[model samples]
Target: MSVESGGGTQAVERAMSLLVCFTDEHSELRISELCARTGLVQSTVSRMVSSLDRQGFLEQDERTGLYRLGPMAVTLGSIALNSNPLYRASRQSAQNLSQTTGLGVNLAELRDDRLFYLANFEGAKSPKSFTMAGRTAPLHATGMGKAILAELGDDYVRDYFTKGLVDAYTPHTIVDAATMERALQEIRNRGYATEVEELAFGRACIAAPIRGRSGRVVAALSMSGPLSELGLQGRQEELALTVIETADEISVALGFTVTRAPARRTTTAPKETAR
Candidate 1:
């Protein structure tokens, strides 16, 4: 590559890295902190930050002199979420699942190598689960992640597994990419995914993929709870089936037709037995 092209790529990378530095804890930062966190010169950080601010990607408080994510970011995110047909149809299904199972239900979409929560429903029970709407989870450790991966073909799954798995909440999390790939393959065959103490200890989740009109998987519907409340053996299959049914309902609502193959006949009765 030419030096000019490489320099431009590096600049874009650095700017994106800087933007990612803002998180739940440090939602706002000053120029000095931005330079320190990004390891870039103050002049370069200031110029890039100013350009981002002008483009409505970053917001700077006039009095506090702190920068946070801007309105355009929220606007773009809103547009992306609203544009998903599966998410639009699954809102009621998620609520119904939450009510029926008395657990937390969520719809998630796979994006940028992560599962992004699109819609969520909390049961009427007070003081429910702590997960928030719009939260993101790694694709190797959560049921929703597996469900989305199961929808993609084997080649896509292999490429995703090569990216490596980062442990998020628990030690049971599948850190090895190969194992995760195998697990996702099984999930694809089974038509659902289950997470038992993988994401959070004592928490179990079941998810199924929501397909689009063209039979492409677009999102996942999941139900989660504490393991003790959800039995490990008997209830797991039942819960998985429930999630699958709910996902199919959502898919149908979104205009995806479910066509079942005809069952094969095993054997024919003997002619002598007809007497």
Candidate 2:
């Protein structure tokens, strides 16, 4: 590429990193905080922040001197979410599932080997303490993550382990390749994945893969709640079936045709059966 184009690309990347540093947990930050999060010098961050502020992508509080996402960012975020095919396909079904079951519904996609929550709908019975829409979670410790893992290639899975399973989030979180492999196999066999206090101490979730028109596991849908309320021991089968059906419905809406018979697979990649 030409030097001018390359320089422009790098600037764009730096700006994006700065924006990403402002997540749900860190909604506002000072220039120093942005520097710490992004490893960029103060001068660079300051320049970028000023440019972004001028463009309405960020705004600075005059009194507190902290920067936060501005009106343009909100407009762009809404447009992007509404235009996303997975979010569009899953939103209504996710809401309906949460309303019907009184269980929190989550839709997530695997990005950079981590599960990025696209939508989180809280049920009437769900705790209203936190929102997960802009959050990310480890692929080795959550139901939705494991469901997607079950559809990935074995070589990819092995390479993923080289990055180190994130430190265990709870006593039940899978921290070893051997154990996680077994869990993936179980998910493949049962057509779903489940996590009990693996990601959080008191939460549990059941998830199933959502396929695209090309028959690829592009994302996952899940239902989550407290362990005692979900009652895994008593209703595991019923809850699993419910999640699987809802995921399949979203898959169909995304243009994946249903097939009565599915092909057997020997590895972790998606099954080669017709959709």
Candidate 3:
């Protein structure tokens, strides 16, 4: 490459590397931390961060002298989701599912080995609800996360589990890798995933994968509720079917052709029983 080309490539690399320094664990960082993580000179890091800040990609805290992702990044991400046909098609279906099931409905996508909630609808009868939009949840412990993982295959699942430490958010949280793998396998075999008080006590959820035109799973649609209602044996099955059918309808609306044959696993096999 020419000198100018090499300089431009290096600058792009440095900018991206700096952006990667922010993580869930360290959502905010100081200039010294950025310099250490990116291995760039303090002056260069300062200049680059200032440029990013001006573009609204980063925001510096006046009180703490720390930097975090800015509102511009959130605005851009929201724009991308709103512009997607899948998101647009799924909105009404999600609302319908929430209304029909009397449970909170959530739409999410797998990113960075976690489920990122994109949209949510609250049920009419839900007493207490948790809002998860723009939040990330563990893959092994959430119905939406597990549904996405089931579609991504084993290698991706392994890499994901290896990167993060599993925590027992509730007594029912599956923290063992082998057991979690078995759960994912069952989710793949069947067509839906379930979480019974895995993420939080007394909360349960069922989710199904939302496929794209190429038959690749791009997102998940879930119905979540308190255990008192969804925990009943027959009620859970009814809710699971509702979630699956709703997701399928939304996928079709997004122009996803379901060309693959269904898996051989029994749809009646309760995921909660498997656990």
Candidate 4:
């Protein structure tokens, strides 16, 4: 490669490396931190950070001398989000579910073995769940994450487990690999995932996978509420059925067709009592 071309490539890589240094845990970073993490010289890191600030990929706090991801990053993310059919379809479904169920609803995608909450809704009269867009939850501890894991099938889930991605978040969390494997199988058979204070001490959730036009799970939709009300043994099955039904509607909107064989049945009610 020509010297100029190679230099340009290295500069872009350095800039991206600096940008990635700002994450949810580290929303802002100093030059020294960036240099340490990226393993780049302080001068190179500073220059790249400055260039990225000018380009709006990052912004610097003049007083603190720290850099954070900027508006352009949100703009780019908006562009990508607006183009996703699942987001568009699931947003409305999530809103409707929250309104109808009077509970908090979440729309999320599994990314890098974690559930990245894309949108959240709280019903007008419902107590709010502690969640919001851009928040993340562990795959092995949340309903939506488990729903996506189940949709990903055993091979993928096992491979991901082999990477040691599963973590216990609460006393109710299922961390044993074999037990979780059986739980995922049950989720698939039942067409939804359920959580009983798995992620939080007194909260429960039911989640179902949303499929895409390709008939593969692209995301998950979930409803969450208090353990006392939503986690009653009798209510879990009912709520799971409701969530799965709604998820099926979203999947159809996204182009997944139910493949059940057609059957005809006649409903015979005892002739209205001739009273």
Candidate 5:
């Protein structure tokens, strides 16, 4: 390879490595920490970080001198969401997940405690699977609905249950307010929700919530199959994670930003480090 091209590639790689170093656990970092994580010379790291800051890919806290992801990253993610590629890939992903697991996949939004499917992909072998793309499913009965409600907090959920608003689609449906409250808390903890024969006998599903740029639960993505196929009764943790990942991908493409604003700051320089 030409020396110039090799140097360009190396610079790109180094910049990307520095970007990935910031994670949920390490949202902000010091120059020394970046050098430690990337194994790049301190001076090289400093130079690249300044370039990234200039490009708006990273922002340094003026007071504390820590670096975190900047607004441009979120803007890029937002742009990707509006691009056709994400929509096409989102549909194909639904189809691929259905094909991979032999399950029906659905994309839905929560409306007044109900799940209204906007798109549906039925598994190859599960042609008979009912598609609710244009229909609504009860919140307490379906995985997607429950997943949405899980993010609405405890008070709203409690009101829903106490008002006798839950529909008992099956004997397994959770009608008790206390029980539903606990389940929602569990969903918050686990980052997903599951329903086994609650919506319909022998049909089970798992779902995850999708957030928008506002960081609110805007929709849900779900997977459904035979109770036996999903192993809902036996082992479905892997399936739950997969469904959550699917929703997360769509959320990212939909311009959902995970970064929080500065912890605390004034128009003047902050007195403390921005968390």
Candidate 6:
């Protein structure tokens, strides 16, 4: 009986792993592609795919044999999003920020060393038919990613680039470790970060880290737009301040209380020590 139970558990895990193989970029995939992604034998993958299809976790395209997520997956995703406290806390604030600024507002959390967008509100000035709610961006290439990285320790940040930065999405991307380190330090000092045409040409963003009640960085908030707009010569500081304030609002909503540093008492330097 114990052996049978263990086998059943293994089967369930494999089936879940198969489901996880589908993503925004690879939403529709063939069984062979699934095998390559999951490294499972064709027979095992085929059986599990069939089971998933029947259970409404996956649906196959009858004409192309490509499989895509089924309704059950969508239902579960909705439930998960609705249940997330961070998402709930930031949704309205993100909406308001986007509406007021006419710039995209994004909320994302760090996952697997990448920024995974949980919600996005497109500005009225730049409406899009789709959203980035379920997409991931590299940690080294986005404002939110940099803002979150600024909250991490120096040792961790150093180790993060030990393998060196990967994927330069645009010519302006910071590819060298020294440059990235300096940028993160600036973010730490300013309480916000900026991305100037790093992820895509003509695009820029300002972002700030969000902390939870535990005083740990839990996510980041950002305002994104065309470089011509967000990168305006005189308005960068204003936009950055707005982004930081909004992010702090979200952090407070998440129960984080700002801990102000004690003011330093300045004393006039001792009379010149001319012995």
Highest TM-score, which number? 6
Give candidate 5 misplaced runs (Cα > 4 Å): 1-89, 259-275
Winning candidate number (lDDT): 2
Supply the global lDDT for candidate 1. 0.76
Ranking of models by lDDT:
2, 6, 3, 4, 1, 5
Residues 162-226 of candidate 4 have per-residue lDDT tens digits of: 89777777777887778888887667666777777788787878788887777788888888878
- Residue 82 Cα positional deviation in candidate 3, in Å, after optimal superposition: 2.5
TM-score of 4: 0.82
Summarize candidate 5's per-residue lDDT along 221-272 as a digit string, tens digits. 8888787777754556677768877777777777875565321111121111
Better structure of 3 and 4 per lDDT: 3
Candidate 2, position 109, lDDT? 98
CA lDDT of 114 in candidate 5?
71
**Worst 10-residue stretch by lDDT in candidate 6?**
266-275
C-alpha RMSD (angstroms) for model 5: 21.6
TM-score order of candidates, best first?
6, 2, 4, 3, 1, 5
Would you list the C-alpha lDDT of every candidate in the order shown? 0.76, 0.85, 0.81, 0.77, 0.76, 0.82
Model 6, 1-275: lDDT tens per residue?
A: 69999999999999989999987778899989999998999999999999999989999998998999999988988898899999999999999999999989999999988899999999976567887987899888898998888788778777778766557888878777677888776677667777877888888787888989998999999998887666545576677668777887898999998777311111111221100
Residue 39, model 2: Cα distance from true site in angstroms:
5.2
Q: How many clashes does each candidate structure show, in the order listed?
A: 0, 0, 0, 0, 0, 0
Evaluate residue 66 in candidate 4 and report its C-alpha lDDT on the 0 to 100 scale.
Answer: 81
RMSD per prediction, one decimal? 8.5, 5.3, 4.4, 7.3, 21.6, 7.1
Misplaced by over 4 Å in model 6 are: 39-43, 259-275
Worst 10 residues of 3 by lDDT: 264-273
Model 1 over residues 1-275: C-alpha lDDT tens digits?
A: 99999999999999898889898779999999999898999999999999999999999998998999999888987887778676668877788778877787888888898998887777653235454557788887888888787667778767776666466567777776577667766675567777888887778877888888988888888887777666645565567668888888898998888787311111111111000
Q: Is candidate 1 or candidate 2 better by TM-score?
A: 2
